[model samples]
Target: MRSMHSMRIASFRVQNYKCFVDTGEIKLTPGFNVFIGRNDAGKSALMEALSLRHTHNPHRSLETVRTPTSEPPSSAPTSVAYDLSPEELRQHLTALASFFLPTGPNASASVFATFRSLLETGDRFNADWANGVVVKADLAGLGGLRRDANRYASVLNLAHPSDVQLALQNEITGSYSSYGVVLANWLRDKAYAFRAERLGLGRCAAGPDKVLSPNAQNLAAVLNVLSSSNPARYKRLVEHVRIVFPHISGITSVIVEGSSVEARVWSIPLESERSDLSVPLNQSGTGIGQVLAILYVVVTSDLPSVILIDEPQSFLHPGAVRKLLEILRSYSQHQYIITTHSPTLITLTENDQLFAVRRQEGTNVSTVALIDPNRQDDLRMSLADVGVRLGDVFGADAILWVEGKTEETCFPELLRQLTKTPLHGVQILGVDSTDELGAKNAQRVFEIYSRLAGTASLLPPAVAFILDKEQRSETEIANIERMGRGMVRWLPFRMYENYLLQSACIANLLNAEDASSGKAVSSEDVQAWMERHGGEKKYFAPREPTAYSDADWPQHVHGAKLLHDLFNEFTDARVSYDKVKHGVLLTRQLLPNPSGALSELCKILDELIRGAPSYTE
Candidate 1:
């Protein structure tokens, strides 16, 4: 086996390929190389061109590669096969003559003399490049058998032209196998290309697969193969999937109902009372099939020097997306070329993985900005600090995406707590799985790593986020942070509302609401309120009920419920659930106070603002 990091497309040169009038040279490295470009910007075309070298079709024609230009190349480049000119034919014979010269085995005989004698007479009849001009061979005499094998040598008139023909028709040396010839065939095995734009992971076929299909219809079979062939690699694939969807217990191949072979991911709920569940790969998220298909190809194919993946970041959890990129990096022996629109994908990519691609207006030709080798790190870090996602630095905010409206409403209030005065400029916003007006995760600072990851990108620019810890597992949280989205903060209290529910704080709020209500509330009343409304599973839901007494009511009472009940118990102006946010805001006015939990949480929020990337209008 080759070293883990052995294959890479050092550089690529293409001409007359679709959309690419002619991309001169694209240098690549053995890692996650991302191509960031606009639609119709030739990103896909570049990937297609790279895939061309591995293609073998005798009938593949050059017409498909034409630039769609007004004038095509003098001749076309064919996909299936090539048609070599007479000049090209002579070069092959000459190369063979050089290798088989009168030496070694034929030390005294000088058999090559017969081959050179025939090369003197070349193609004088047909001249494609030079119209109406012809050059004849100089050969006067040669043996019949040797002269016939070098037929193109006479046809070319000993002239040389760029050869396109890949097939060899004859071997004059009378050898069934030649070192150069056999080695050339073996080299093709060292590299190949896989285009996955339209992979069909679910289109079922009853039988097992000899190899994975382009659409991944045979994904299950491939998974089975990988497991049997290399268990460690198979385990790594499962680990990658687990990072994307943490609930997954394992991945397996199953022959369902006798005919259909399927890849399935099984999930075991965090709760032991729940039974483990399994879903067919096709029935799972589209990203799952895509991720699995890619891993199967890269990990098991073992032949390709380069892998071309277009928009690989689509439909992937930000964690899975990073995991996929890391796989490409770890397998540094092979090269990866990827195109993407996801900023999350760009977030974790190192500077070298980036390639900013753009097409000139009204032109099919696209070009990549060459990052100067010397300034790559500085330039990359600078872009990252300024929040240029996937090479696009737009007008966005240095906002914070937090849970609950209280987080949003508490923004100005949070600053007041920390600074003793409200600070303006930085914004704090809230968004969730449900599409909210003005809540696009596009500029989200931190996306919650729940099933709601699909909607995470639909937010205004916080350019960073810190998901509140609730049912989230530590591993899941760490996986999300590893994706470089943002920090995940565990609330010091039961929830954000708990910050405002402290006994001392509640006592102070009651004092503000009613002078007579200034006295501390008994913990028994707080517990009573929780037991009453806690069935609804609001912010204060806990698995076990804990009793509380005076001075500790806030520890047990739901903050919003406490405020609601406060008005009913004392002051009479109706306090609705909506008004509790205002109540929380009011409570924050007394914060960065003596309360340890609320104050500490406030400091963390304050530091988040200070540390996250900031953008301008």
Candidate 2:
């Protein structure tokens, strides 16, 4: 079975259909293509448009599919136009020509030349051409053919005069109405639309039908045939399923004793001292059935196909979704057009093209934007890297910009402890330092925020910026606050690490790190080390130390440098304070019982929350 095909739908256009008044030809990739959008944004509408084109029922009305308008529906027909390659055109004509041309030496050559001339001359027939000439070749039809005979002379000339009369008498009585019926059946066989909600199947009549239905209603029969005829493929399918669902040991079929009916089921191996068990697929959970159906199509497809899947992550776990995408990509013989709302799905697959579909406000039209994956700041790639998207930032109720990655991780933990609930719709983002923002002044930060907020209304309405004090003088801090219009808040301490100056937390971290060496650092040892090193006059509060007790060392000392020095002094322990790793760990520890500095930080966070714009769920 050959998987690669020379023909494919290159592009398509949908006009006056549902939310699409005129979706100027949307191009598709030969491989993985994704359409991502919110609900009712016309992603599924595009899938239905493709379905309408290749469906078997010819009388399926376009009246219900047309966009609502005051005028009669027939005034502007709802139509889908598919642009095919010349090779596909040749294949369509060849199938049609087979019915008319006789079996002889130059018959094949004549058929090819006739269609080649039709294609080269741009005199190809329309969708209804075969209906008039072949289906209803009465006197009126013959008169119609004579009127257009010059355009199809090559085709008429290919047949002997006797063969032409015979074809008109016999072949015209065949079932097909148009040449498109050949292409339609071909496409119907090669296309599969997967809808999880409609994917349930029961016991099917036993037969050799190996073709899985679009919704997999015939899954039992298909599996039954595959297991007997192609056991290798069936085994491969089970292996792939087990990768996603480890408990599924093997697949088997149970035949009804007196009837020719079988049920496809899977066996689960023994676990936790329990015996193995077999469960019918219909009795299994939807997630399991969905995975089996998806894997069945993916493994058994022996031709180049178009697989339409909507929200593939609906019933499956994230891990399963990731594995399914990996399996789909490994089999590149098919083109996959998936509609999804899961950022996990969007970020996981290496899609050939991603289209962001959006319905226009105050209009029925839906528009699509092709997102370039190669861009430096592509939203999906950003989600993969940092688990955040610009769209997420915009959708958030309030934005809190922090200094770096360390602060981004720790602040959320701190806020959760203070508020006693997760902050809803508040996004904590990590950004560069003040020096990186602008060397001269803080005005550049506002400029960057304004530029982001200006793009397509995609920024949160309320935003706050916070950065480390970082040895900045009182005058510099005042200047930044003034230049930033009070939007920026500078930490009172030297850095965020200063709030994490707990001796017990530091000792526990060191002990955990040096557990293998049977070495430990006590809280007393940490406190004594801090006292000796932190009581220096240079580390005093208010820029001067009258006495050790009067000075606030944690407030004035460089917290990052102190931790680095402590790690150096503890040579026996295999512990090193990674700013991101240890910083978050220490913050989590301090959050339960905050020190004076941490208490003050909590107050600042409370004030920010109170000042932020309120939002309703």
Candidate 3:
């Protein structure tokens, strides 16, 4: 299933599509084009237009148009002068409407003619929409003809009404259009909008993989087909996948019952692993299913060069997200249009790749604008003079770039509760998980902050950062302070988990769920676990390998690793703990009874809600 040749969508233009009012045209780079926006701002609608393409019937187009409820049509003229038989009227209307359907030599006149073709009682159009309505199917079909009609209207604006009508008729019937041929070809063509995105991938199944749908629902069948028929493609995919899941040596799909194929990964043992180890690829981890689906599409499809993916980072960790991105970068032949809501994912991209999506003011319509990531534009330069950075130009008012998912996950809930005030325009981003390079963190902070911060204030509270302290040296801390200028912050504790260890935080979480709901760690038990782990005596939480009796250890969530393992349950269908979710749940639990453990966090959160406090105060 090797692609015939590399293809890319040069550009896409929408006329009357959803949430788009004549979004003239937008060019896309051949490599990766990132579409970033706030929720409800039309990213989904845009993908709909891209997926459906400019093909649906005229009635569909009219129905999907961005119509306001306030303004209804005054009236529609149904009768075209003389009284005629039902057959005559239907023939006449259908013919007139036929011109509206993808008019060109390649168009399908039958498609336009037959749309909502049957009238009730052989006289009425459709029994389904037969109720009282100003405009009927025939008239509704006229919507797509506006462009062609307007051309004639422009030329004959001054002519007599009868003459103008005759002229318009002459223009329509006189000029030849090859719409049917073009449309017929398009319907038969495979080269168009190609899509593979973050769609519902149910629990692992050995379902028939005969064909891969938008979400790769038939992943088993897809992999089986490729592995059997196209080994080269399969091998190529496995190699790329190995970069993310180093444990996998190769992928094998076996035919199961009912045309479904079972898929498994031949994993390399942690040490010199055995070939006998096989894991269900889908059930192995939190995001492997989606990652495999995406990679599989690239390997085994006759895809149009214009590839569309919406929220590709869903279910993937920060590290996994980076690997998926790396794969996308390698496929330079296809033009990629990707939508995302992760700060970590955004940092992986450049300014040129970023496009800001927003709703047009006071309208349901939405528009996407190119963002200058390099900060090299005239307007951006002028803003810098006033202390605004290019990065601040489009994103949220406040951004806290942290070290990893645990930090990315927990802080927002704590802050959201602590701030009390709603945070509509703030963002908490996780850049990475490791803490190897202190200097690099400082540099990235300076680079990103210079672009994202809007105010020259010592602490530009609107847009800032929070990275792990990671036991940084005094010198490193001072350097970071110089760059962050009090705006960027590092945890006073070892990591985000250290904050969770706060006595109040512990009591709050362990109490949220009682043994009745499930099982909850008790405060007394937590204290015992702490003393047992020597956490009360140690300045920082125990790292790992405690000598405490495994039997005596607290029976609830305690210890950094235990806490992580509790949250690291990615595949438990009943439970899900990720950076994005659970935080809200945790926040609700902690809010009613505030925690002193988060006091230091409160001040930083306050800076975001209300600008930095006066030092004199």
Candidate 4:
């Protein structure tokens, strides 16, 4: 068994394959590698190109896979080159020498030494697959070795010692007649490409073969073999299946007609007295089949394998996807190459290499940007400080930016009550302040947000900013609104706390909190407090008589300050108002009969939700 850190495919280059004209040597990590991009961005093309190195039929026509162009297909035959690490190069050379050299007179040792010497002086070794597979080496400084090759040919009993180079090439191209077939066979034993659509329902001819097929078509046969040959591993597989599907007590294979085997799941009965039911795996949900196939691959494949998965989340739920990722990570001996559009998967997987693939419109070439590991770490920490996961931002249909943490918690509840439905597709995010943008006008701030959102692929598509009107003049308010271009709006009040100034609701919240302390508050107490503080004149009066009405006084007063003073007035009681705690309580109390300000806010949100685009899988 190879060590967990054994040399794997370090990097690969693809040329003239579908959308990839020339993907210049995209690097990979030894552990987990992830590719993220939008629809039709050529992510799938890159995956297919990587899988080409392990294909069985190396002689397949290039016309079907080659990039279409005005030039002849022969001029641009599809090619994929894999760079070999030093360890891998040594392994291949060692194997080649052992297989070809005569046993006596230390012939194998001499040939291996020659190969090693060539490797030491060479710049790079690449396994290029185009018309056929060939190991290309930059042996520029090995002219003396080629001239003196007769020394190796004599021991190997070559017919023509002068043509030693030809004989060596023939030997490198294995007994399969072509190095392409040899390389393909080698990769087939070490790599597995998992495509969910290609997986068969768990049934296959019973055989002693324990190796799983690329698409897991032989899953049943593989399981049957494992059950008899390796009982411990078989038990482990059943235990893992139970973890992912709790209802499944065990997995068993039953031979039918003395020839074929079918995998079945034993479902635990709902009642203790009832016996467990055995059902064919085909009868189970597609999600379970996917999970079983994935688990079988991860659990049974040889060590140091390269597992390529395309959008596992497409077939599994978020929870199942998370569990599957955990299983994959636990098996640290294998390398993983996964492509997904699911932000949740990208956020959860701590990938060794992360690439953002993009292709311009009307172009066949695709480009990849490798996100720096340090930057990704910084992003994770920043999101953690805000109590958010990157997936949360990408999963929403639209983002509603609020002033602070208090509004972030209370706005959703208020909107849910007014609309009679939870805010399903909208995510309310709290910003430090709109003033942080340092823009003189609303349009400039919105423009900055739009530009920032444009660069961040994980951010939600539609964004709307809502903030307090503060002390802006009427003329200034009108100008801001006009310049906003529908992407920004003001609260029409000093702050969100202004809407929670209802005397009855405030008093009700206070009494509820003071119930255990043998103290109570009434609506009259709140009303009298307001009256003592100058009644409507003190709270609602405008500087100009004809400017606004007393009913609109909540818009001008400092409701947060007033609420704090009201809480201080209750010195005899044990209850006090907190902006986050009491603010939400007061908002809930006002749900039964929302104030005029809240109703208008609800109207604005409804319009925004209707216009915003909904998220799709």
Candidate 5:
């Protein structure tokens, strides 16, 4: 019995192709591999080049191009191409030759394969050759590699190893059928791309020469065959589609006009039972069609498949993109390559699977593999100065947008004080605009937070808002009241006024005994005393005299003193701790959901008790 080796993309390399003027290599895995880059960045080109190299089909070949319609050709075909400069023709042929070049050579593109299970022949003889395929050019003749001539001779003669060189050449033999099988399966799976006109809106099936139509004109007929030949598989496919699109209550296949086979989707609406919402296969939404196509390729293809998808995020809703990523990841035990520009999709992937592709001037493409530095918080922030919201651009669990480093540096300490716990996965971000970007950007971070607030998901920490209130208690209170609800909570304090209010209350309370007792000071004296202690009474009025009592006055004084002590401890520099403390006490009462923020603040008290390094330190 022959043992089966797991199919893997041993290596993928590209050079001087399309946007890639420089050489680039992408190390792939048996599982999912992702290619990420900005628009027009050669991600799609890379996928196509890899496919072209592995499949060894000529560019503009009928096999590579999608045929949309089932109509027969109107006339006999003609191959007319003669005009070409010596250099231009040389380059073109070299490209054609590169497709057949073996791995590990100086070729425009190269791929190597090492089968998982070695074939033990009756004679124990196996093809021992150079590392798969390599590309060699006629540097002496045309100032370019001679990969085409080398591979062309090899394909012409199966057993002649001496005549054909390995440069840009892959191993070919009767025994190494797995490669061909995988390639054929991939082509068949992806062959589903068809245009509206070619859909043969009436043709049930083509002659024996053609396979399944990309636009699925023969979907009904194909189902009819499957139902008879493999009824179980057909049933399973329908069930899977229904699961992916719950709105699709059922699928009914029919041979419509022109004898074309089509699948009709039934929708379950509020007033009606399942009704036909069957959009013609050609007229369905691209997202729905793309999804169905991808799912079909992933599940039903018979060979060990390595699905390569470029811009998998296109046309997908944000939620659907996420679902697609999850599904891809789950099915990735088989090989697959997905490329995307969507940051949301990037978040669904891990750092290892991601490859950041960048193109330099002159169209030189460079790829950073192994690990993405943008995966780290600090490196991502480094890109912020250049106007890249790296956090949003890369999909972080939460984005804490601060004005600058001071807020960035102080947040962890603040959270430690509030939660009395460590801040592990929270990502601190700096954005120039919350109003321009709006709360929407910030809301994304919070959504992730809401998901993790009480759950133990692998997701990062909850994202919380910490904008400087500009010293205004009213603004801080109002903003919190507006945005705080459910699991989403904004931290109190936006402006400097919140602390000022607390300072005034504390000052008045402190002076109460001094006034009521022999040393009891009047309101005027209290305001004057605060002025001497760095208080901003000019900007913030003290609480009314009636708002305090002798006993309550002492309590307020103690609150002010505590604030002063805590503030002094946290910041070595002098801060209006009394005012902040006084405001905190008042703000706590004003907050509809103060429990969360207050609990966080109380942890600060415990930290002080435990003698944790003060903010000043």
Candidate 6:
């Protein structure tokens, strides 16, 4: 595997923390990384440690340094004992700092264990960005109340000089009078970590200043700001969300009768018509919104933070899962640590960064980098050796099919440029079309390709037939469509017809001198030729025309162009056998799957050609 950039955990070690008893260290890649483990595997615990949350109890004592005492100092030339040198002491401190720095923007800052714990709870919190302080308190603490009976209390009571309050509170017991002034001041300055969840849109805590609650209910206000002040940017964000959910045709923000702002998705019909099936954002599928929210945070946030997610793929459909993985992989440019049960995501990319977290007995947790290059290669090879196809292992994956040695030659390169999607299970097969068989022979080629695809259980891309459209009688044309029925698709113009039409267009555009000089030919002459040869001129014309007269062309050209134009219009297009064998070779390139309609046409053509007499009449 090729290394892109270097990012290291710097000083990550775990001993007697969570499930890890033996200390373990892991290196991190600079890009998107995946952590995989089964249930109860302590993966989350491992993430917490890396995030600077204390993995061990804070009460544990550090062993004090001892120095050797000089014996018989007076007699032994005043030998003296000393502790570790200042340099050694500095080295130890540097090691400690490295453990928390994390090799990024926040690597130098000291992380607070108390703040980390306070973040786990559902509440509002503040982080003093200026002072590097995190003040977290319960909802009640933010308000000016310390009533033990009130369900909603305030963090106001926590404000104070700690040593003085400790002494005073011990003496005063339940009285707030003595602690009032100190509690209020301390409460005003303390900060907290708010988990990004509980903050939906309405929850607000009364205090001097609330750090934008990561999970406080103030999220609604943020959304409101985005929707109103920067609607265009908000729309762009929503569009990014839509690419993952292609079925969601449009999303509009609306306030329901209850006056709550909500985002709704409108469904689009397969035929391009609109329908009303607007679902509220909150009520929408969890997977869609979860994936969207994660993306939104990664893109929108400015904080130097690592997002720790559990079961990121929950409720996500396979296709959506694939899309989500793509987005996540792209977002790896930022820092995020996600846990999932999805093998699809785990193996989504060959260069994915992976780590495995394992829990051991007696508070021992271990995390080891699982994205080793050699091991990944071994895993892939072992799978192939075991007769396991990647598609089978990964489910009915998408595939591209290219026909013939020529297509097999350059298809991958062309596809990479066109789609930008990674090629996973695409296969190339030769249909053996070199023989002098007519266009109907495409059925045989399709059968060979389809059978191989079927055996492999790889769903072919909408069939893109690269066969030529040949000259044929009505019976023969129908025979080809029948032959290709479900396997082949139609290409525009017969092979010779498309070239001749293009030739005619060039011929028409130039005058007699240009035509005679081989610079151009008479379009009218080509037009007249089609009229005499029982073909359509306008439909078969190579150049785009300002006007088309359907009545001017004959049956052969008209009928051929009709088939050609139909395939062009069809979504998920497949190619017809006739198109491949004889149609103008369209750019000498083939797409993955043509349209599904084309697939059906190919099947129909196959049946037609199979039953037709081998000896042409």
Q: Highest lDDT: which candidate?
A: 4
**Each prediction's TM-score against the native?**
0.44, 0.49, 0.40, 0.50, 0.43, 0.41
Over 1-617, each residue of candidate 6 has an lDDT whose tens digit, in order, gives 11212111212344443444433444444444566666666665555444433323321112111234422111101010111122222222232211111111221122222222222332221211111112222221233322232121112212232211111111112223212222222322211221223223332222222123333233333455566666776676666666567567665554445545555556754255443466655666656545555555655643223345665545655545555555555455444456654455544233346665544344334444464644747444323322333332233133222334333333333333333432322233324423321223555555544565557543444233444444345675566566555545444334323322333332332332133343333556545544444333465455333223343232135444644443333211333323432232331222243334333433443333223222110
As a TM-score, model 4 comes out at 0.50
> Which ranges in model 2 have alpha carbons more than 4 Å from their true place?
1-7, 53-72, 75-176, 257-267, 270-276, 348-351, 374-617
Compose the digit string of candidate 5's lDDT tens values, residues 458-562. 433324345443333665546443543432333243332323334434444444312433443344644454434433332223432312323333222323343
Candidate 2 lDDT over 348-435, as tens digits, reads 2223788777777766678766777545356544344323344444545566777776877677666656654234445566765233
After superposing candidate 4 on the true structure, give the runs of residues whose Cα lies further than 4 Å from its correct spot. Answer: 1-4, 53-69, 75-110, 115-125, 131-184, 269-276, 348-351, 375-617
Stretches of candidate 1 above 4 Å error? 1-5, 53-71, 74-198, 202-217, 228-232, 257-260, 268-277, 301-305, 317-319, 347-353, 373-617
Tens digit per residue, CA lDDT, model 1, 325-363: 645555554566777655444432222556666665665
Model 5 lDDT-worst window of ten: 121-130
Q: Candidate 5: global Cα-lDDT? A: 0.41
Writing each residue's lDDT as its tens digit, candidate 3 over 127-230 gives 00101121212222333442331222111212342221111222232433333222222222222333333333433355434446654566776677777777
The candidate maximizing TM-score is 4
lDDT of 4: 0.60
**Which ten residues in a row are the worst by lDDT in model 6?**
73-82
Instruction: State in Å the error of residue 432, model 2.
Output: 10
Instruction: List candidate 5 segments past 4 Å from native.
Output: 1-5, 53-117, 120-246, 257-259, 268-277, 348-352, 362-370, 373-617
As for model 4, its CA RMSD to the true structure in angstroms is: 19.3
Location of the lowest summed lDDT over 10 successive residues in candidate 4: 148-157
Query: After aligning candidate 5 to the native by TM-score, how far in Å is the CA of 501 from where it should be?
Result: 42
lDDT of 1 at 263: 72
